[model samples]
Target: MDMGGLQIEQDGQTLRILLSGVWGLPSAAGLDRRIAAIHAGGVRHAVIDTSGLERLDTAGAVLLHRLWRRLAAQGAKVEWPAPRPEYRTLFDYVADSGEGKVIRPPKESGALALVAWVGWLTLFFLREARRFIAFIGRVAESAAKVALQPRRLRLTSMVHHMEEAGLRAIPIVGLLSFLIGVVMAYQGADQLRRFGAEIFVVDLIGISVLRELGVLLTAILIAGRSGSAFTAQIGTMKVNEEIAAMRILGLDPVEILVLPRMFALILTMPLLTFYADIMGLFGGAIMAWSSLNIDLNLFAQRLQDAVSLKTFFVGLVKAPVFAALIGMVGCYEGLRVKQDAASVGRLTTRSVVQSIFLVIVVDALFSIMFSIMGI
Candidate 1:
């Protein structure tokens, strides 16, 4: 039915409205109210029949847009036909979904979007990794030059590192390992004694200590001790501009600073682990002898029999890798410092954390790889 130059028709779920006379604020305002009423009545879907619209203006366009928005927001479906040339120009400012217009897409790019996002992330990760690799390569090259010309990496630094990683760590590593052994021995004894298999405590302590605990305990100790020390020393040097001074003097800081630490760490970590294994074994022996009444000689024999050179060497080999990783991480963090004391401290802590985390991750990788190799 026609009502004041506007035609309105309701067909089931659709309410079609048409504008005829010169469109203005009056037409838009009336439709806004009517759309609100329709929404209130839960008439969710409708078509606007603009077939009769003539001489539409800004107000006419705003009125149509307002109804379109209200219908959309109320979960009402609305389809307005391709506007007549006269009316279409008025709604040209409409963009995006909130314009209260129904747009049917010819195609969707959801899959393509996901692929692009994932590809970007992958490239980002690879770029970061490549940067790290490049950094390592530069450090190594600088170190090689220093080694060739300056004659660094002498016995003194190596000896000192051995003293620190091995001799200095011995007491704590030994004590901890011994205690771990003792606990293992007691636990094994309590259960094994029932089956007259108390001797297996020796095997348990030997295998566990040699293969896993010794390496792990040693790594944790060094991470706490040497890892932090590496970071702090390099960080302090960095903060003091000593590293920059070396660079100015044409001295490769990596060789003078980092290479020594690398040598020291690689030199001592295995020794520390070896010492730890011994200590853990001794502790286990003590527990076995005291709690299980197992013969010390028998425990030693069982330990020797149960722990193979292969297993012992495995832990030994892993220690150098752990040390290298720790040193790398520590040096990386230290180098990142921009001379701030707070940043130095923060970087030191991060170095230790990252070192320990990488040690575990590398350990897991080693375990999996070795298992595959039947090690």
Candidate 2:
């Protein structure tokens, strides 16, 4: 029967599709309806005959591919006759594309589905953990090599990343720390005033900020800021196929891209933590003087007497470790990005989340170790 620009004939269990005239964009709507209406029931085999076609463009090729898939889905084996060279190329290109094809897992329900989901999640987590460890090993190896041959290190890139991740982050980090200190002092003063120990707020702010909050908060902020930036930056490069090009050119992505950002964060995190500590104390001092009626001079003396070198160093020591975690997770997720804008966006968000989670977990482990050692 004639169906617009094509004809369909059934002989026994075999179905044949015949094409003629123009099958380009103009006739696409009619072609779709006619192709969809073809009777494939009880048919075991189908063949596409393209010899009668006068013209076929990309849109036509796509529609033809769709028809092939539709017939196959109905349990009929679809075959295409060899057409012109140009037709073959267009058909192959359209068929090979991943856009229109979707692979979905079989559906399950009830307890079995829950169990399967849990199993899948467990496997996913374990796989991700393995990859992270492997990435860390690669970074360590590259870092050792760079250390031995200092000339190979990208000092200019390191400094540039430092300015980007460190210098630019100061205002927000300092502002947040200062606000936290003010809130801490205000709350601590209010609580302690009932027992006539409003002056002890100095010790509270000094110990809490220096021993924990300063570095912890700074690392968290950096994870959300610079960590996401690293992912988006590298992810975009991957989407553009720049990383593959770099590999072809014999350039190490780890050395050129990862190390500079990681080392920059490592060097700058401690400085940022120190600055955070200072701003935190200054804010506490201000609050103490204004709310608790404690003199600024007395506040300074109390802060000096309360927090020791060990307390300050305790927080500083965690900075590099947190920085490494953040930078590595970001770059790792970025490198894992697929060649699409959606993958870039998805992995950038995942990088920030993973970096923050890892930072907190490591911080807790450090806290336990420090406590056990009585530091």
Candidate 3:
């Protein structure tokens, strides 16, 4: 305990101590005796001179803190004198944990760790994106080739999918879009009623539906439905060796297999988007009649003024790009499926997720372009 040989002295009845080095328990009795002697001599001011001290462990630091706190409770003022700059780290360590082992300042490591982590993520995403892009290229090429030779495109299968994609999907899309429009109108009316601006609810629903919500919702739904279906279909073909057989027969599988599905989705998405816009407007009309005491005909008239033909066209413009993204992802996933049932499902899922992400990204790009053109 007294390994550092603690010494207590007095100057004008003030207690002062010089810490020679590191101290510990074996000398606890001697240190206690020194403290007692200093207190008995009526020295209430104490200073710990640590300049000559070399090292102190957690236990030593704890002992010092307890003694300092104990003396202060008894009204003795305590002070610790300056030591080597190296001790600054030790003090900071003590400050943090009160484990009290004063440690030296730590050396700074270069920013390599942060940079390395970011680099790893960047590389991983880049690789995934490259693979997706390559798949899209193949899909587009196959689609174009088959399109050029109408004989290769299967009209029957194309028509079947168009019905499945466009007609079958209508009810769900319409229901969801209608509910969204009603909810938005109600919320807007509730807020706008404070300022007698309830009529503006018509403008909000009309403009928002025509420009953004209708297109975005339709894209998300198709991405989940058609995108996954494409991957699964293509994946099934791969597993069944149909794709391989077509290739072996010197036939471009892209034309016979992938192109029809791609074109079918592209042709159908815009029609669905337009349909959704009408359903949404009808929904808002219902909300206006129920909550705002506005007549359905009046609501329709207000919506017509706000949602012009140009607004509808801008939304229509987004549909083709969104549809193309969804189709491309679906076909690309279908093509990349390894020859296994499990691989087919996994690729299908990946394709749907990627397609949705790309759809949002492209939608944002369209929004920016429209803003730049002041449209």
Candidate 4:
């Protein structure tokens, strides 16, 4: 007997097949050719001898089962004679399990199925919205409780989160804002130079950064950084049953965990926006001096005459609202995590995406409001 090789002998109306050696995945290659050869032999009956089989795994059993089935289907009788216990067990298991089973075709779906899917999604969205509103209400109630009883507030935890989310983020925020300012100044300089209005690059950079880009970009970065971190941290706690334990101990997880993050972001975001504005202006000044050949003093004087304090206030005003949205979405998604590792990853990603989306939407709303008010 050869490894993974079959020997066939024909005697009158009977056929004898000998299977030998290893017949697992690695050795089962070319098995289809052997099965085809047997099928083309025109034998009416066959005996599968497994006595020479040195090693037989599930794959070998499946191949053997398929050969037996094909022979049986072709009006040939197939028998296994005195198989070893292990071989008999493997063969019988594979045969009973119906490996290489026939596949049923999928049922066709029409307009009714499409309508059902749409209805299901709409209901799911409504249910999620209800839960989110309830979560927001709980967060607000917790904040009110903290406000009334200052002792219940976790000052140390709040400070720690503020440092983590706000202080640590300053370097990146400043760098990105600086680069954006430089790019804006460069582009504005080039365009305005065509009309001999290079000095107005200062106004372009100051007004754009202060009124919109600085705060919006800073919020987006925070959503991806701190927002994702909040979701992952809380989601991990949920997975570990720590949140449930807090409830068992009569402690509010929202008050203890979520409140501190929300408050810290609310307090720190405006400060970060201010810092971003200054850095962006500084970067724009440098680019103005170098690229547009506008003196730093001239750029400053032009900025003073063109951009007002109201423009700066308008950008900083959006910071706290964006921060609250980011915090709520992050904590909400975190708390929604199921008791699984995959759920933590999925919810964390959702938190970042949802937070960023809400921040942009709120920014747009503010823009519309300010436009209406003629700011």
Question: Each model's TM-score?
Answer: 0.64, 0.73, 0.68, 0.73
Q: What C-alpha RMSD separates each model from the true structure?
A: 10.9, 11.0, 14.5, 9.5
The deviation in Å at residue 229 for candidate 2 is: 1.0
**Model 2: how far is 168 from its true place, Å?**
1.1
* Per-candidate local distance difference test: 0.78, 0.93, 0.80, 0.90
lDDT of 3 by residue, 151-171 (tens): 767899889888877888999
lDDT tens digits, residues 1-375, model 2? Answer: 222388888998999988888778888898888878876897999999999888888988988888888889888999886889998899889988853868688877788988998999999999999999999999999999999999999999999999999999999999999999999999999999999999899999999999999999999999999999999999999999999999999999999999999999999999999999999988999999999889989998988898899999999999999999999999999999998999989999999999989989999999999999999
- Candidate 3: segments with Cα more than 4 A from true spot: 1-114
Q: Give each model's clash number.
A: 2, 0, 7, 0
Please write out the lDDT profile of model 4 over residues 1-375, one tens digit for every residue: 456878888888888888878887876768866786666256788888888888888999888888788778777788888888998899889878868879677865888789999999999979988998999999999999999999999999999999999999999999999999999999998899999988888889999999999999999999999999999999999999999999999999999999999999999999999999999999999999898788888988899999999999999999999999999999999998999999999999989888988888888899899999999
List where candidate 4 sits over 4 angstroms from the true fold.
1-71, 74-124
Cα lDDT tens digits for candidate 1, 169-218: 88888888888998898898899989998778788888888899999989
Stronger candidate by TM-score (2 vs 3): 2
Residue 36 in candidate 1 has what lDDT?
61
Looking at model 3, residue 63 earns an lDDT score of 53
Question: In what order do the candidates fall by lDDT, top score first?
Answer: 2, 4, 3, 1
Mark the regions of model 2 whose C-alpha exceeds 4 Å error after superposition: 1-113
Total clashes in model 2, counting residue pairs 3 or more apart in sequence or in different chains: 0
